[model samples]
Target chain A: MSEKILIKGNEAIAEAAIAAGCRHFFGYPITPQSELAAYLARRMPKVGGVYLQAESEVAAINMVYGAAAAGVRCMTSSSSPGISLKSEGLSYLAGCDLPAVLINVQRGGPGLGGIQPSQADYFQATRGGGHGDYHIIVLAPGGVQEMYSYTRDAFDLADKHRMTVMVLTDGILGQMMEATATENGEQTADNRQEKPWAVGGVRGERARNIVNSLYLKPSELEATNLSRYEKYKQVEETEQKYDSYLLDDAEIVVAAYGASSRIAKNAIDEARSKGVKAGLLRPITLWPFPKKAFAAAAKKARAFVSVEMSMGQMIEDIELSIRCSRPVTLCNRVGGMVPDPAMICEAILNANKEATA
Target chain B: METRILIAGFGGQGILFMGKYLAYIGMSQDRQVSWLPSYGPEMRGGTAQCGVILSDTAIGSPLVEEPDILAAMNLPSFHAFEKSVKPGGTLYYDSAFVAAPGTRSDITYIAVSATQTAESNNLKGLANMVMAGALLKSLPGADGGVIETAMKKTVPERKREMFDANMKAVTLGRAL
Candidate 1:
C-alpha cells in the first residue's frame, strides 16, 4: 500500500495537472481557486515551468489560448465571475480545436456573488457557458482524490479529443483537505513539442502550421462545425463516467454530482439503515450526463430526487436523462449553502411515500 | 470508527488550524479524513470554524452537519455550536473566557481552562493545542502521541519554539 498524504483540493488539482505534463499555467487569482494558482506559482518555478498570473481573467484565458495553439498542455482556473470573463476565449479555443483545460472552482451567482462554495453554475457548465454552439467537456469530482484523478484525465481527454475540457468544482471542495494517494500520478512532466497542427516552424521538413479559428467562408465554417460535432459525438459515446451505490434494488434514486454527491452518500446510507431502499447515482462527467446509468436505474427506482447545491439546475438534465419515466423531484440548497443529509433523507422518505400512495 | 469534529472560535483563534491538525493525524494513521473550513469575508474578524471527519472507511461527506465532537474556544463559539453536537457525543470548551456553556445532559461536556493554562505557561496562542490535548484524552480511538508527532510536522522549522510551548500546553491540558 502506498503512503497517503493530506492535500487540499485546489493544491491537489494543480499537482495533478503538473503530474499530467501540464507545465504552462496562465490564470488570475480568485477566491476559492487562488490556492491553485498559488500552488502552481510555487511549484512551476522549481520544475522549470512557466506560471504567469495574467492581468485579468480575459488576458489569462487568452494566454492559455496562445500556449495551446502551440500545442502545449496549458491550463487556467478561476471562480464564477472570472469564468464569465473567459467565456469568449473558451469559445475561441473550441472553434480552433485547441486542447486546453479550464477549471471553475465555482462560487455563487449570475453577477458578482459571494465567495462561498456553490454548484449554481451547473447549467452554465453543461449547456455551454460561452457563446456559439460549442461544447466543452466538463468533469465533476466528488472528493479530493477524484479532484486529482479527474484533473489528470481532463488533460488526457482534452488532448485525445482536441477540445476544451473543464473541471467543474465548488469553493468548498477547493478549500477542503483530504488524504489522497499519489500512486498513479506521473513523476515527471512531458512537454513534448511535436504537434502537426501547432503553429511553429517545421525545420524545413514540412509546411508551417497555421492554427486559427476564423472561417470567413460560410461553407468552410459549416464544415468545421460539422467536424467538431462529429468529435463531440465520439466523446459522448466514450467519455461518460458515473458511480452508483446500492442501486440494484433501489426504489428511490438520489441523483447528484460533485460535493452534493458526497452528501447524498450519507443520506443514502442513513435511508438504508431505516429500511428505505435508497441509492445514489453520481454523475462524474457532467457534460455527457450519464444518461444510460439513470435510464437503467429508473426502471427500478420509483422516484428520483435530484440533489444539488443549487436551485434545480442539474435537475433539468436529470429529468432528461431518465426520460421522466418516474417523477423527478428537486432537493437543493442554493446561494453557497450545502444540502443537509437529514433533509435529503426526508426527501427520499417522501418520495417513497408518494410511490406507495 | 468515524470521528466527526467541529471546531469553532474567533477568526484569529486558529480554529482552522485545529481541524487541520486533527486531519493530519488521521492521514498519518492512513485513515480516510477530510477537513473543511468556513471561509470568506466573515473570516477577517468574525467567527471562524472548520469540520474534520476521520473514518476507517471511505468518507462520504466532508461537511459535518451534526458533529460527534465540538471544540469551542470562545463564548460566541460555545454558544453557537453547543446544540449541534450529536446525542451521546462530546463537547469540549475553554472555560477561561466562556462563563456559561449551557446545559445538555445528552452529550458529555468537558470545560477546560485551556486559555488560562496557555497563558500561565507563557503560551498565549497555544490554547488550541491544549484543546487538542483535551480532545485526545476524551476520545476513545485517537492517540496523543500520534497527534504530537503530527503537530511537529505541521509546525514550520521557524516556529520551533512555538512547537515546544504547544507541546507543554498539550501536556498540561491532558491532565484535565
Candidate 2:
C-alpha cells in the first residue's frame, strides 16, 4: 500500500535496497545501470548509508564483500564487462557464503560489446558465474513492478541463504518507466533482526564471526562444500518459483524467461491466433530454475522452444528439467540484437513444423 | 490489439520521452505496455532510440526489432529504421530534420515539419513531443483521449510552469 510513480527499474532497485535495510552500496558507473548508482549517491548521504564509486568493478565488489562480511546488507551493480571484472569477488563471496546483492543490468557481451539490452549473461549468472563450485541466487525481473518487488526479495534471500543474490536484467528493463512501489516511505523494511555475528566487535557477548574462505585443510573444505550443496538443494526444492502462461492445453510451448519472455509472449499470441498452441514458462526466479512447474508443463506440452537473446543458456536447464521427455529446440539472437516477434513466431512455427512433420 | 513503436532521433531530441508518453497512454487505456530506451555509449550524444509496445495482452519483449510503427524525428532515424518498419506499418518523420526520405512502397510515410512547428509554437526543444503528437494522431488503433490525458499527467504536480510548456509542446507536436 504505497503511492505509485513512474520510476526506472534501476532507480527502483536502489530504493528497494534502501528499504530492505541495506545501508552500503559500492559500484562503478556503467550505462543502462548508472541510474542505480546515481540514485544511491544522491540518497545514501542523508540516510547514513555508504555509497562509494570504486576505481573499477573489481574494487566495488570487494567493497561489497568487506561490508557484507560485517553482516550488513550490501550490494554492487555493473554491466557485462564490469560483471566479468567482479567475477573474482563474486566467487569469493560465494565461497564465504556472504549475504550480498549484485545487480547485473546486462548489455551486449563477450567483450566490450554494444550497450543494448541483452540476456547474454545468462550462463555467466546461472552456471556458477565466478570460479569454483558455487552458485549465486539469480533473479530475473521482466518489468518495473517486479523490479521493485525483486529488489526487496533479493536482499531478503541474500540474508536468508547467507549467499550472494543477483538481479539479472537487461538494459531495457533497467531503463524503462513504470508505476508501482512496495513501500510508501523509505527505511520502512524492518529487517534488522539482531545477529550475534554482526561487525563492530560483536558487542558484549557475541561469538566471533569469521568471514573468509581460506580453509587450508582438505577435509574442512570438503565439509563446507557438502553443507553448501545441501543448502542449494534445499533452495531448489523450496524456492523455485515461476509463472506459466497458456500451458494447460498448449501443444507448442515457448520456454522463455526474463526480457526474452516479453517478446516470446507476443510471438505466442501471434502463433495462437494462427491456431498454433504456444505458451510461456516465464521463470520468476532464475537460479532455482523452477524444475517442478516445468516438469508439469512437459506432461501437457508437446514441444518447447527455448527462446533467448543469447545462443543457449537457459535451454540447458529446460533440457535438464524435461530429460528428453519432449523435444527441446532453440531460438536465439545474439550480439546485442533483439529478435522480433515475427522472427520468434517463425521459429515457433518452425518448431511446430518439426513437431508435426 | 498490440502496437510496437520505435522512436529514434539524435541525442537530446526527446525520443525517449516520446516513447514514454506512448507507454503512459497505453497504461491509461488499460493496456499492457513497455518503454525501453537505448542506453550506453550509443545514447550519450549520439543517435538515440526508444521502443514502446502497447498491447491489450501481456507484453513480453521490451525491445522491438521490427516495429509496427516508426516515429523517426531525424534523418538518421528514418534512414536506419525505414526498412525495419513492418509491411503496411506507418512511419512518422520530422520534415525539419529529414530533407530526403527513402522510397518505401509498403508503408505509410508521414513527414511532418515537427521542429519547425514546435518553433512556431515558441517551443524550440520539442521536436520529440511533436512526433508523439503526430504518432498519437496517425497510429491506427491507439486510444485518442488516453494519450491527451497522459500528456496532461506527464508534468509533475509541483511544477505548473513545466505543464504549460509541455502542453504547448504536445499541442504544437499534434498540429504537425
Candidate 1 per-residue C-alpha lDDT over B67-157 given as tens digits, one digit per residue, 9 for 90 to 100? 9999989888788888889999989889987887478889988888888888887888889988888888755556746867777756765
Query: lDDT tens digits, residues A1-357, model 2?
Result: 564656788988988888888889997998878999999999888778888989989899999988888888899998898999999999999898888999999988789987777889998898767889998888988788888888889988888888899999887788887666557426486585555555667565666677788899999999999999999999888888888778788889898877788778889889999989988889988888888988888998889999888888888999898888989989988877777788889988988998898
Q: Each model: TM-score of chain B?
A: 0.92, 0.92
Q: Model 1, residue A49: what's the lDDT? A: 83
Q: Candidate 1 chain B TM?
A: 0.92
Give the C-alpha miss distance for residue A107 in model 2, angstroms.
Answer: 2.4
Q: What is the lDDT of residue B97 in candidate 1?
A: 71
Those runs of model 1 whose alpha carbons end farther than 4 Å from true positions after fitting are A183-186, A189-194, A203-205, B156-162
TM-score of predicted structure 1: 0.96
Q: What is the C-alpha lDDT of each candidate?
A: 0.87, 0.83
Minimum summed lDDT over a 10-residue window in model 1 chain A is located at A184-193
Task: Encode model 1's per-residue lDDT on A230-267: one tens digit a residue.
Answer: 98898888888999888898999999998888889999
